[model samples]
Target chain A: MTKKNKSALSEHTGISSPEITSSNAIETLKAKRKARIDTNTLVSSILNKNIAALSRAITLVESENHKHLEQANTIIKACLPHANKSIRIGITGVPGVGKSTFIEAFGKHLTSQGKRIAILAIDPTSSITKGSILGDKTRMETLAKDENAFIRPSASGTSLGGVARKTRESIILCEAAGFDVILIETLGVGQSETTVHSMIDFFLLLKLAGAGDELQGIKRGIIEMADAIAINKADGENLKQAKLAKVEFNRALHLYPPKPSQWSPKVMLCSALQNEGIKDIWKLILEYKTKTTENNYFETNRTKQNKFWLIQTIENELKRSFFNKKEIKEALEAQLKLIETNKTTPFAAADYLLSLNKSLQ
Target chain B: MTKKNKSALSEHTGISSPEITSSNAIETLKAKRKARIDTNTLVSSILNKNIAALSRAITLVESENHKHLEQANTIIKACLPHANKSIRIGITGVPGVGKSTFIEAFGKHLTSQGKRIAILAIDPTSSITKGSILGDKTRMETLAKDENAFIRPSASGTSLGGVARKTRESIILCEAAGFDVILIETLGVGQSETTVHSMIDFFLLLKLAGAGDELQGIKRGIIEMADAIAINKADGENLKQAKLAKVEFNRALHLYPPKPSQWSPKVMLCSALQNEGIKDIWKLILEYKTKTTENNYFETNRTKQNKFWLIQTIENELKRSFFNKKEIKEALEAQLKLIETNKTTPFAAADYLLSLNKSLQ
Candidate 1:
């Protein structure tokens, strides 16, 4: 038997076949390669300026799968030390405000100055609306083809909180990849701007001339969050109107209480359409960075933001877990019916539901 | 048998005499009475308009003892069927805006119209500040002595949410006790007004003429929540400024979105110190009631408010239970430290703390 050394399959078939040899060990090695310690390898690749690996890591971070989330946590933990070295800027405007044009122009300016820029979006409704599909690249053709620029569309999630979380994680990955400037774009008309504001170093608001948008911004509390207001489209016949808007926004920005940064907000005119006055806006942000950094508000604000996220995450997950249970869903319906029938008070019903959850635990 | 009855106590304690009686049986009867469900009796008494029973029930509601809360729940569950009959009005203003006088004047007006009124304060009291104490009664002396009115000071609690809950339950008790009107008062400078607004049918904000207060109101979003703005201190030389403020506030009110009740908020001038414009305010409220009721918005809004309260109670209790646990507290501190040292992300830290809490269950 030793001399023959026949395989089991060959013996069962009563045939001697040396050509039927198989290497199960080799296949096993190949199979185990991806499953083994991908987190460390991905972090090293991201640090090595490997864009493909960075994109893969972000996909894992955005995945709703349980196992993917665990892997993403490992990668995020490894990347945290290398992260937070870049300047984060948030840009917002309503639809038809030339956000795409402004971002492209702003990004081109930075890249020309030897800066690597990354653009991320926080629109939860992007999947249905003017999403970042292949057609979006056409809107920013020159920037999309630039070697120093990376553009990722908004992550799709059913909830704003969920999407905001993924974008936050993606920022870490992008920063680890050595992006010098990160522009976070969001619509100025909703809560997304507020969420984006909490995560950025400087927030910029863009406005077209005389769109009746200032009142909308004031009513939505967006004006208070803005660190700089740029009256875009300040070229051709729009120049006169844009100048007027700048003075109006200047007056509006002054009414806000002094920022904790101790840096006064400004209103500037620019023409993303003509790529005019774009560098001045960048200079203003750098000035804000210098002022806030000197006053130590820069680091203090980040610390406060981190604390906010920690508490927000725990509270949100607590509610999600409590509400997601099958038992809770069925019992909550019954309790609400009891409430409508006048058989229970809201407080009493709340107590009963909580007690039921406790027992389940 | 008689010898044995006397001997048990004496055998245990040889100093016991005949005069030393033990009421183990009768004391048990007295103790068991409160342990029994007094819900039905309290409900009947409340239905009969017994103010003493209402007061006792409210005391139970305000009590911190676990047993008392349980009894309070029973009483509230019984009162739920008879509650929601009266309109709840929330009155708010700055500390020096003569809120007490306005409430007194407002309370007496209703009582004189043959309406039984109940006034409750929700200031979330502390040791300092101008709290509602004996001086408060002196401030509202006429209304306090009126047979048709009931005035209670703010209930004390460790948290604003706790105080709000107690006051809300007290509102139910008052309504079941045949109160035709319920006034819930809170300070305008803080978060309590928003909490008060959620539970009320109408919201009233009192302002002083030309006190540089409208800007503060707008900043706080109190003006947007108001159903009616009443300018107090409108007598004598202040009358002209009050008229000017009325126009300014009217312009400001028009800028807000249309209210769900289809009611345009009114800006009225009143001198609470002189009891001016009091009758017109009442008539306006009456008109509002009739209009909202005709369009079915009244019932719809109440249903929405009930839903809000139910979800609010559950969410609040869930957070309280999680944070109150000693194990979660220690582990959360460690997790937060990990976040500070960059050993974990906030999202990751939240996950770990939540997992630690899960194992605790």
Candidate 2:
């Protein structure tokens, strides 16, 4: 404890103090436990308006590290009471549809009206490189810098299609942190749009107006899931084409039955670059909410969506586990070979493989 | 001494030879073991100019007794070498499309051509009533008595949509038995049509012309899968409309990509009831086969189909076993509760439940 003793200890240990290694080890242990505790506490604190804690909690939830998941779950649970306040809107379109630019314009317009906004970019498309995320933020500089607007570029290292569960859970955390409106931006990976739609209150599909031939490749089921179709970049020379495309979409919409929510999806045109029709888009969403809520479709839809997620998640997990089984690994290979050779019917082979798994159990 | 003993035994048993209970028990045991051996042999023997075995095998395959499936498999395997020679065709349409009557007409035509034929009715709509199968055969009495033709009704105690797997396997058996063509008749359930399509070399979708509203509910995907769309009941007053529908289908076929085999799926008009266009209808299926086989599409498709069954079978088994777990029972219940309460994301709850499954060794 004396100065002379401390110097001797530092010199002998080569660590400035003999207790440094042990203390550092202790500190590391404490930090991990603290992180775990903080996740849940941060969730609660952020629910009470603590921004720093909320950021940490969302980070934990999005992490791929196995240890982080439980802490993330606890945090999500703590934040649950304060969540579900905001209107969660999911926006998706093909790669070149100017989604970030539209979000920037859309967010600014909302903030101008004194509305607080949270932009949660759930990019399930490609990996989020540092350069790309920065580029995305740079494009939305105006909205990014606004005090009333919170823009979070998607967190890194998760499944493509934007770590569906994390993005969904993060929405709750963001809403609990008091952002009145939540915007979820999804990439136009054919299937990710469906995942995003399942989580959000409103799903808006953006399209680039073009010939009908181009529309054939996109899956019809996805087009039917959209609550509203906005033909982006609708100004300038493309204006007439955009209008025609809108008409086409409206005709297509007629072929589909009304959604279970009883919402008659709308098709509109907008030039996100010129910030044209941004206000009308917002107004339409509000009207949708009002109509659906009046009909009690909003609450019912959200509940049904929740149930769908649960079943989907369980089914996916079951599939993953079955494929992962060691015994099943060999049995499947053999069964597949037999199947390829046409020695057995698929149902019979399936029964045989399944019986093997059951026996093991 | 042997004659005296035989007389005493017969007298004591109160029978011409053996005791009735002992005789019945031996017969049951023998039947069970035979059933376990594979039913194909019986089908092959019966179909390959052996009427007795074919009838016996069909009965065995249709038996509700657990031992029959084994016998069926055995008989079928024995019959396999004879199966691949026939052209398999699937026929399906809504009720009153005159399915039974059409088959009668078609069967008679084939028999007249000196071509042996076999028909298996797969009717999910009609339960296995005491007379339903026999009734279909009775309706086609003239065809049924033809030495060159065979007609089997839908089996009871199996999933609807057609003759069960054993029945399909039996088709191959019948073909090997020297039947040049096999026709699968399915009840007009729209969805079930897809199941039948996967197994057949050519799929014939029978539709009543001008059934517009009903057609809308029938998915376009299924229509796209059809190799030939036949506007059936095209005789008399319906003839003109049937032709128009056939033309419309031809146009629709143009929209789909050239099938992978480069086979141009044909659309045609026919009246199974009036026997109108029956010969042309068979000609179309034959032409399709010839064209596809010339391009090697026919063999390639069969291989692909076999592979599909293998993977599909394994996947189903995995699903069944995973869901059957005791832990999943609790996990599912818990997740359902969370889903109901909106406490967890469906994806997250699914991941958690799946993680609880015994880790693959």
Candidate 3:
């Protein structure tokens, strides 16, 4: 059998089945036919809010096989029309900043308000473990059991770029599956925050009050990218400190030039454990949505982001193809050594290497 | 004459002299031969601290003529062995922050210490005006006349990439001319500050006292890139306010993560008019240099910067070539319209556009 057919068959079986009797082969062929039909049916099922189909479609999008890629593209094409109808929010904080608890509380609040919520994560570190850090259903017990909420862990082990692409595609599947709100979670330590920030309409950074190292929870540029900051765990003894932290963050935000979005970033206090101040944070998101929608920044920003990702993808592909060239790879180390020794300028070396690429001619 | 010869002749004449009789042509040919010999002479003159040779070489590097690029590259190749011997400092501040006066005072101070200083500016705004805002000799009258100081305004307006390339090349020529101190000035209002930051060994931000809008003078990322912050105009009534600002800025810097270079950025107060604290600022730079050099960060940082520029130039060139394709240009607007209307995904559009470029295949 061809490799493609073998992979396609294995895709449905979830295992590589060796050759068997003619009857088993016939059954395998039947399953392959059914999988083809399932692609279209999956779209209709997703549109009707079939959770199982939505999950399977997301799996297909995350698959590395060529056949799965083609199927995923078709699924995405069908889902595209229904996507972008949800409010996507990216939540991030350091590991101990109660991100999961805050998200669980926040997700439950949204569901209680009659909004269907889908929670996703883009954890770069999870790729190495082959299991998502946020995927443990026990961490979000209440939300995990809620019929109105769907929680997904970060896609299993892949490059950040690969993981980011899968999560973004999964967003389309979730939106088409009738989720009205999407919550994207990322660890504050890595570049995942920036990727999550770009894909979401609102970026919410969660910080701990009086950590004494308040800025330590988030990366340097991440604060500047935030649409709003929440000092999480602001209950009990931490109340006064949280309030002061809010004021301090507000002052720091003011020091930054106004965002091009024309809406000033805000600071708020919240306690996920107490389930306090949750509604106020949602209200802030609503107000931001209103202001940005009125100013047309909401749609324009998405369009700009789309274009940015498009060009970025192209650039990445071009660079990959260029560097993957065997000849160029062999020459690069020597050329870099020349640059290090100051025997040749960077521009001159770049010119020489580019001249070596046959495709440029 | 061929275009190459025509341009080569124009390089020496500074104009296109119309065709002449044999006798006049012989004289022109002699001058052209002399110009060919002058290329090597220019290298020797620059190595001998001939200011005129350095100036002319910089102009050649900045020229638009294709012919001059070859000549400039030749001169740069010869100078490579003599470069990388200077301590390059990048200074930036907003328009009303008294950048010119501060630089003038700083330049004079360096010259007084028996240091030959070469000052260059990277003004993005000047590119649109086709004349450099800082190029006026009158702006730094004293420094312009100082025998130990060579002050050149921003190169005639070009794209930021073009201007940055020219300035970087000019640094090589300046260093070859035995200028041990180089100060690169950039207007704080644009992306030019980041460009200047990447190319220099140390970055200094100059501000004013009692400005109320202290952060208003620079972009969000610029402060994080600074090696030290200097509050200028600190003498007179502004002294008290300047000291307060210094403390505030110190607190702010402490909030940032430690730089990879392992040197803590410092904040100081200075007054250009009174020339107070000028020496102290220099001392700070010297201290930073000693610390970084001992840690080997200075050399490593320069090497990293070289590799960065090399890759960046390749990326930019690849993007330029791809986008400049006539067919791609024609299709881009329509594809952008599709994206704006959400009729297609950015990934799908990028794939389609990449396929259109025959070179990719």
Candidate 2, residues A177-238, lDDT tens digits: the string is 89889998866665667777788889888888884443342333567778888899999999
Please tell me which predicted candidate would have the highest DockQ against the true structure.
1
Cα-based lDDT for every prediction: 0.85, 0.73, 0.85
Candidate 1 per-residue lDDT over residues A242-281, each given as its tens digit: 8998888898787778988898889999989899999999
TM-score of chain A of each: 0.90, 0.83, 0.86
2 or 3, which is superior by TM-score?
3
The DockQ assigned to candidate 3 is: 0.47
Q: Judge candidate 1 against the unseen true structure and give its global Cα lDDT, from 0 to 1.
A: 0.85
On the 0 to 100 scale, the lDDT of residue A278 in model 1 is 96
- Looking at model 2 chain B, which ten-residue stretch has the lowest summed lDDT? B213-222
Candidate 3 differs from the real structure by a C-alpha RMSD in angstroms, to one decimal, of 8.1
Q: Candidate 3 residues A1-361, lDDT tens each?
A: 4466755436454566765768778998898888779988999999999988998999998888888877888888899999999999999888799988998899999999999999998986765664686768899999999999998878875567678778888998999999999999988887788788779999999899877654443234777889999999899998998899999899878767789789899998999999998999999999999999999999998999888878877777778778888888877888899999988988898888888875444
**Higher-TM-score candidate of 1 and 3:** 1
Least accurate 10 contiguous residues by lDDT in model 3 chain B = B211-220
Worst 10 contiguous positions by lDDT, candidate 3 chain A: A211-220
Error of 3 at A198 (Å): 2.0
lDDT string, candidate 1, B219-330, tens digits: 5678889999999898999999999989988998988889999999999888888899988888989988999999998888877777788889989898898899999899
Total clashes for model 1: 0
Q: How many backbone clashes does candidate 3 have?
A: 1
Q: What DockQ, on C-alphas, does every prediction get?
A: 0.60, 0.45, 0.47
Docking class of 1: medium
Candidate 3, residue A36: how far the Cα is off, in Å? 3.8
